[model samples]
Target: MGDHALALGTAWAGSVQAAGFIALPRRELTAALVERAGVLLDAASGTGDPAAAGAVGRWLVEAHFTHPSTLEHTLTVLGPALVRAGPDRGPAVLAALARGYAAALQERTRAEQERITAAAFVARTAAEQARWASEARFGALFADAAIGIAIVTAAGEIVEVNRALCEMFGRPADEVLHRSVDVYIPADDHEHRQTLRAMQAGELEHARLERPYAHAGGETIWTDIVLSLVRAPDGAPRFIVAMIADVTERHRLETSLRHQAEHDPLTGLPNRTLFFERLEAALEAGRHVGVCYLDVDDLKAVNDTLGHDVGDHVLQTLARRLAAEVGPGIGSGARAGAGGSGHLVARMAGDEFVVLVERPADRPDPAEPLRVAQRALDVVRRPVVSGPHRIVVSASVGVVEREDSASGSGELEKAADLMKAADTTLHWAKKDGRNRVARFDAERHRAAVARFELSARMPDALEAGEFVLDYQPLVRLTDQRLVGVEALVRWDPPGGDRIGPDVFIPLAEESGLIVPLGRWVLSEACRQGVRWREEHPDTQLFVSVNLAARQVREPGIVDVVASVLAESGWPAHALQLELTESDLMGTTGEPLDALPALAAMGVRIAIDDFGTGYSNLAYLRTLPVHALKLAGQFVTRPFATGMPDASGEDGHDGVDLEVLALLIELAHTLGLSVTAEVVETAVQLERLRKLGCDTGQGWYFAPPVPPAAVPALFSGPVGPT
Candidate 1:
């Protein structure tokens, strides 16, 4: 096509001779395969890797074979390029292209073979039956079968046999013919003898056994045998017909299936079905079974928020955890029952699980069950999450012994009842606080039933003596000075112990009574703070209370806070609203706009659990933030180990410690001071001091005791080292 075309072709021919092997793929195919072949060739020509330019050429050649039409088109385009290219470059380019095409053709064959095997095996029911029938007849047609075949007498005796049978028994056929079949059987036959006798007496239609048979050599060979009773015209027994097939492989598979079905698929622990079966047997023998019911609190929330796939990961982690606790018989002298093992755990359903323990039957006291329950409770309380969600879900266990089950009805029912009760107790644990485990208490059922009914009567209970507040002091770590008090919501039952916010707060949230309940706390805490300030004006006490995430976004939140300030005549700067990371994350942009308005009014916005949210720095910086309270977890290790918060290349100071430091610095740079929470030791204090931490709070300053203890804490020693 061009004046240099003849010269380019001549140069390319020399390269083919110089390089012993080279491939030529079509131009159109190469163009189709390579997103930018020209750019790839141009860039790779400068690379030191000799394979790079050749590899790309091979990739294009493979595409040509895959799409055959592209091959002709690609070659036509390539000819023009080769004709125009200067002599030296054209030869190298053509040589590389030659080898590439051949490699592609070989790869295509491998991909095809793999596809044939991957296609699903297809067979009709009749076809499968025919194949099995044909397979079964393979050995049956052997005329002179070396193994013995037999027909037993009417009385379950071996009455007839073949020449092979006589040889096997080391006796003449007549001498061995009438021998009793049971003579060669094992002593502890269990029910095998009955099954064989049933077949001989026309009771069992077919009975099979691979039982040991004694030979003339005084050795035993386990035989594969099937028994079938033969009948005369009037239904009288003639003799038993038998067929035998050696099945050592099939027997092994059956045993393996039994093992798998009994154990958990994930943890290899006994499943609920198998556990109950074992417990039933143990109970029948008057065994004292200690049962612990466990539920991983956040498995579902992890599944729902992150994904079910990740939730499965959490379950696996939990299984490993439970295994480590009370595993390997690590505690050599643990309490034991009549049964052999100490503990058995089972995953009953999603996130719900159970643990069964064997307690010493000799003990008059039932403290051993409690000890097991305590151990189980401790194991589950540890924080375990699949991926991003670090949730601590504790379990509640109801441990009841099978004291008097008639020793025959089975432990399964009793153990199951205990499991149900333990599950019931766990509901109360959730009521108490999600991370606390509760042991089953039968004596408290009446009170619990009342509480259950109270769910219906909560609105009325709110009007009654249900909710109140006791203030806890928020003190300055620098000096033993009272800066503010956090008002904790409490619910006092008519004439009993006050229910914690843990129990009733969820109830309030569920019933949508939090709006009223929260409103009441705001007004009450404001009124109380204003009253305390008036009673002791020199004190200048401020009130801080938890504001639910739902309240943060509500249009009425601003008005309520405003009304509280106006009615109580307390300064907004004195009151601080502590909202959790989730609360801030859940808010929309406009609802979040309320933050600026509140900050403008002098109500300080503190992001509680500062390091534990999904907020990016861009959004965090745009916030009307007055203070950033570090979560206890992020700085707790540094606090414990006396380590300065510094960065290293290998990345694990504390999850994102560097990022947090930057966040703190960013807040500082934006004219905001930061507070590090859970600063419990002097080392942590020193670390925080070095980090330029502005405020510190934890038990190190003062524990949250009674409201009356506040004034004493202010005057008394802060804490003992």
Candidate 2:
């Protein structure tokens, strides 16, 4: 058993060495492993169990023999040793050993994958630390590494060169030593020299750059050069150490990967990623930049008509023609000049492309962008030939230009903003008619930006409690008595004044935020109404909350409303739910159907902004509504021509009075009361009362006030005078 173990361990060590596991001496490693193998052989032969074999595998791994070949070689050597030592049980023992080693190897593979993932996560910071910590090993690595190495004085004169460095440059040591390191750098590569200068001046501690070096045979050798500055014991600068790795094949692979990543596979045009990179560079260069965003017209229609194959062909052909007309080696009318000014054409997305032009800072030309836009339009409108098919394709272009400033400040417009404006302008061009160009308008962009900001902040605002409700009094138009208060939701964003409902309400409704938002308002209004009712038992005031169309359409709206009423302990009759005319107009939907069930529970329903919608008065009769809230426009339009006299009786002319009277009569005939909104002036108030409006609300009584001020408004018999 002892001789068999010794033989097996010696063979295993040799196999590991062959597999590149030579960290320790062969004799020492074999002697230690033999002792461990003796224990494994006893267990495998006696018990026929693989536990000892697993232990041996772990021991091998701990000694850094974890390569795939190490396991293969271990089994190959140990199997034969077992067979020779104990022929009767050799095959069984060998099988157990193989299973144990394979199991442990699987664990090692998983551990190694995890280690690689962790290493990649912190590679940059870890690399810097490792480079600095290995200073003592640097001498040995520099001398023994297969790659090239050189030590140069701070003045850029080479002081020493290793054999590998000489072989890499194809030159003798005598010919390379004492020469300026800059001789190897290409003439056009001034950036490389600047890096060296920075290193010498201590502006940088270490740097790596892939650059071409002049070889002895008049050929160029691409190398990844890692240069680090060495300092004296007292911290003064000493010399520069450079490690050169020949990365010709690596460079080719990298270039191919970059091309694949940055170009459209089908069209072979630069993609959105590359376009933004060029745009950023142009912005950084402080040059006047312009972009002409283009979209192929009716591409989807073409795809649907003539299968996608021909559609793809059309795009490819168009791309080729566009590139041929306005790219390198072709007579592209638009070109770039010094100061990093240039033109780049890229595919923004499916059927959309953009041509970016940069004008030299010294020559700021306003007409350049217009000329490029016209040229691009002309190029795309030409007919394209995809195989046997001749497809006529046209495109719309949106052009945007920026003025060059000495500061190159991007505070006003950034790359992302610029791209968005171009997109909006492109949409404008498409709307006007395809096959044309449109320029960005500042006012239009501002409106779009404001809408976007309002929509984007809605969800966060709701979650962060940026929303609150203020109450506006609804009064009986005849007696000027406060009947109820309408709960108006308002957004008071952080560090900003209150944003009115007009700005963010429609925004919330459009973005589907009204469902959750409406529920919150319902709960809050009910809570406050219950408090007010409890405080002033004599007052029969109720809370009127407006519901958005989306809120009405919600399948769970009935449950949500019931939950709020139950939670707040507020009477259902004291809560008036207002829905827009359009919301209740969906005569056959769940919302209209749900109204009767809610009204039966003592929840009064009213059609708000009544006459502003296209819904007929006949449809109003079908709704389970108790009141009609005439839109503010009907009341305000009467006074628009001129206000009434001091008596407030002569505000409305013939048509205004007739319209208001007829609507009220119709509402009364349908068994519904009428409410008038926007009664700001006494003339408006007296006029609404004469028109038989049941209740009125406006700034005349009180603007929407916070919840804390509700007590004061209801403290008296009537609201604010």
Candidate 3:
């Protein structure tokens, strides 16, 4: 019994410390607890005494183990301690001990309650005197409260009002007290009346909202109002308590901030963000949406000539004028023009603005956008006085309309795409002539997109080796002997048919991809030239590669040519570099210097598309010596005769043989060979030979063939040279 008591005391001390009961000395508390528990356990085990359990409970309460959990721990720990003390103790005895402990705890609770009731009885006698004073204090506080307070009866009549509520409503206490609550709310405010009815009917226990309150001064005061229900002891509804806090300043600030965010600061017009928001809203409502994308024509010139200050003034003035003419506030009462009240004019960005117009719901007119655009154009053409300068400006407008619900993208993206299409059409209007309105055309836009797609794919196509070269024979005009072949590039894109140079070459030049593409052509042509030279050693055929103007101006032209010749082991004399007439006519610097240097290295240079670009004969004579390939338009002019004579003694064909004769003679005088292009028939070939044309290239000789077909052409028969 002594050992079990000591162990139980130690365990109890540890558990109490763990439970944060650390006010007393641990050793004293543990020793006293163990002695008490041993005595209690002995009585309970020997006689099964309920008094022993009651004593244990009282001891627990005195030790300040008043927490239910602490009491539970005490009882739990005592169970084992009792078992240790009496080896024969059973569950029945433990149950009796639990019942006794619970009775003791209940009795302690009843005693505490009795003591509270006695204290309350004494307080009640004193509270009667304090109650009158507390009521007076409450009345004073209510009168002096910062927030407005009002008490209203269940019948919707104001029962009482504090000083703040009287001041808040600008009315005397007696005048406001008897009035209905409806005086504070407008009769047209059905929604507010419905809310009030719901609260009064017990449908709502409490309600809070920000609403405008009517002031006796004939102005509305915004307030954050809260209504709370008061109930009697039986839970029956009593008078309602209403509290109101003035929020007029906050509401004004919020409105001002929203205006600033949505409007352009300089022009006081809606900005792009708000314009897109309105567009999305209209689309969501499934309204027919139309927009006029307007651009200030030559506005950059105005900015450059005057200054940015003047430019800003011009934009602001223009914005005001456009708004007056095309916006909903135009003219007078009826919203002016066909736009009605469903229109928005916004400044998109620098030098660009847009006017959004929606068809009226009663009568939808598809042509209303055009009328809006015309009005905007008329307004833009008016002169604006900025500072001392009276600047006259014109604008171009592109209009597009959408009648279907938005698809393919979300609301914002669809609006963005619509604006983009409008901008594109606006560009077209500017291109045709500034200060005009243009409607979006599906075919033109589709063609433009196709061009963009082809241009986008050029670099990848080059990387994938989809580009290749085909050779067309440049034959001798006299005997039709194969003298040279012009190398033309073509794109054989994967999963698509062959794309011609006419399509992708110009695209390449525009995108500046021509530099590498031209390099590939030059290198590949030289490489193939070496193979042809080995096969046709006696023929002495040269390979020609046409060069774009940009490629000729590239910094490393001479080096590239030298590298290609060195790499291919092809003689430089057998490679001809063909340049367009404009390339050689007006050019200087790199091309002029590079051409002579290349000629000095024994590489021949020829002018392709001669008689085009109106080359200066005097200037042409100064370029390094070369052959002139006459443009195909000259020789292919509908030959009149079935056969043409080799001699020019008789003017046989309708072709201007006189001009051809003079051009050939001019070339010979300059010590240059002349090549005729498009010499298709025997008559044209005979006429070119008679005119002293040295070589000819046309479909009549052969269309451009693959490199594998070139060797076969070399073995074929040749006419007399």
Local distance difference test scores for all models: 0.60, 0.75, 0.75
TM-score of 1: 0.38
User: Root-mean-square deviation of each candidate, in angstroms?
Assistant: 23.7, 16.0, 22.4
TM-score of 3: 0.74
**Distance from true position, residue 411, model 1, in Å?**
16
| Global lDDT of model 3 | 0.75
RMSD of 2: 16.0
Clashing pairs in model 2, backbone N/Cα/C closer than 3 A: none
Candidate 1: worst 10 consecutive residues by lDDT? Answer: 113-122
Best by lDDT: 2
Residue 202, candidate 1: Cα error in Å is 8.3
**Across residues 1-721, which tens digit of lDDT does each residue of candidate 1 receive?**
2233343334433433343433444343223333334433343244223344457557654433323334434444443454244222433453455345434543443343223212211122542321222333433432244445676777878865666556655768777667887765677986778887676667766666666566678865445665656565456665675544333323332344355456666566767778888777766666666666666665566667778777777677767767666432225564333235457767776677676666445643455556656676677777765556686655555555554223445423466665655667778777776655576566464456555676666788778757778766665546536677777888777887877887777767766778888888888888777766665656765677788876886877888899889988878998888887677666443327577788888998888887777556566667777777778876675334554445522223554455556766877887777777776777666556556667666777765554555555444435553
Residue 28's C-alpha lDDT in candidate 3?
87
Per-residue lDDT of candidate 3, residues 239-347 (tens digit) = 5767776656445434543565577767989988799998888766767778899999999999899989999999998898888778863334637344555468999
Clash counts for all predictions = 13, 0, 0
